[model samples]
Target: MAKAFASQGDLTEKEISFTEIGEGLYAFTAEGDPNSGVIIGDDSVMIVEAQATPRLARKVIDCVRSVTDKPISHVVLTHYHAVRVLGASAFGASQVVMSEKARSMVVERGQEDWDSEFDRFPRLFQGHEEIPGLTWPTTTFEGRMSIYLGNRRVDLMQPGRAHTAGDIVVYVPDQNVMFTGDIVEYHSACYCGDGHFHDWPRTLEAIRRFDLDAIAPGRGDALVGRDMVNAALDLTGDFIRSTYRPAARVALRGGSLKDAWDAVRAECDPKFSDYAIYEHCLPFNVARAYDEARDIDTPRIWTAQRDKDMWEALQG
Candidate 1:
């Protein structure tokens, strides 16, 4: 397993690092890129969050092979982001599982998301053509599902909507370990383009009920030990609060989107400027925050054109 880093070129072409986070559990992370999790069960393996392309996924396969010979039976999507689910076919898993809501989201906005994300972060989708098309779940569950990997149990539950309408967490109770997709990040700026800001903190509180000793976050390094785990959660919570609060305040004051964006940057940059992806996420985060604060519960779809327009409007 390798350490995650920040890549500057095509994301699909970037190198990925797979690190063991617990007994038979691994975190596949790229340099400040989206992450995937692997759980090697007694008889088979479960991969959570597929990368963006088959070519990139092969790198994850190679890492998994280095650790075990078990077949990968399932690929679980924590949500329906193109960067996270598009590379699923590469795993050859018998079943691709996702929340029912996630499947709906894929059908509704997957193509638009794919185009938007690829345009925004070209470095994360290095081999863009290698994608077999949008990944769909062969199996979908509502609320929660408990999967048995031989003697081990993996609980896939949607605590609440935070990062997206279909966010989920993979809980390994026996190991006291959890894989929180983009719901919680460590030293990484969270992208909130499709988030429910008001519901996000409550979602975090739901996640805290797990009493996890270790956490494989969506981005950044794996958290080990309770102290580090708390620190990661706290940092993530603070980041979300600091980002959304000011943006919401400005929006409520009838300020323009640019004003809200500038207000948020003024409040958050001093504290979180050094966090990974801070510059990358701020514009999108502010946009979503403004929408949510204005009583838009559902995030507006982000087409490639809309993405560029928003970036130029907020950044330029």
Candidate 2:
């Protein structure tokens, strides 16, 4: 636990890197932090997932500015996580887009989630005071929506529920690149506190249907080449399965929460110990896995108090 806090205070924010994944498509990845994608169309730019705060998003905006001067007309939220969507205001996009389910989740539990996440990962929320409020999508869709940036077409599709009920992937067809939020983490720990463990594998399958040459995951390095893309997706799927199945099995056998937590830790930590945030996410992942395994469909809402209590129970 002390080792986990060792890097917790290392909050030296770095410059955002704009990597050209494909033609006019770039992935803006910070140093092992949450990532945002950029799609440059003929006329304007579309940003996927805002950073934790306006100040952080400005760094992403600065990266975009270096590549193109196009106005960011749209900000697409992959899900409603505070680290991913709270920076929407900084983009100043005319329309902030999200799935209908995500928008509803925000309306229902956004404040609690914001508080919970801020406490859990203080480094990500460097400028929490500047957050305007809960990020509400100005426009939302049910299944899928297509928007053309001049001739470049960006497809927003809810392949299935993985990270959250409203996880959406931004697909650029011409480039065969997909910007998958937390659904596929490349060498980064998958945060599964609000995830759908059973449906996550199916969601990964849906993501594989696309002929993706490159994948910009929610965190870590941008995956290039089909092999790396497939590997990332497979590794993420494996992590989810390894975390949930063993915990669920223990819970079904009437094991205590601590028992299930130990089971999942034994199974997952060895393989994923070297991944970023592995220690931080394991406790929450085990808790959620135990709940879902016991037929708790809707994940229990995590408030700030609940976060502290759970952390003490599991990690203390």
Q: In candidate 1, residue 234 scores what lDDT?
A: 85
Residue 64, model 2: Cα distance from true site in angstroms:
0.3
For model 2, the superposed segments whose C-alpha errors exceed 4 Å read 1-15
TM, every model: 0.95, 0.96
Q: Candidate 1 regions off by >4 Å?
A: 1-16
The per-prediction CA RMSD against the true structure, in angstroms, equals: 4.1, 1.6
- Candidate 1 global CA lDDT score: 0.87
Candidate 2 differs from the real structure by a C-alpha RMSD in angstroms, to one decimal, of: 1.6
lDDT of candidate 2 over 1-316, digit per residue (tens): 4333323555675556779999888898876789999999999999999989998899889889989999999999999998898888999899999999999999889999998888767778877889999999889999999999999999999999999998999999988999999999988899999999999999999989886899999998899999999899889999999999899999999998899989998998889988987887888899999999988989889898987778777767
Global lDDT scores for all candidate models: 0.87, 0.89
Candidate no. 1 TM-score: 0.95
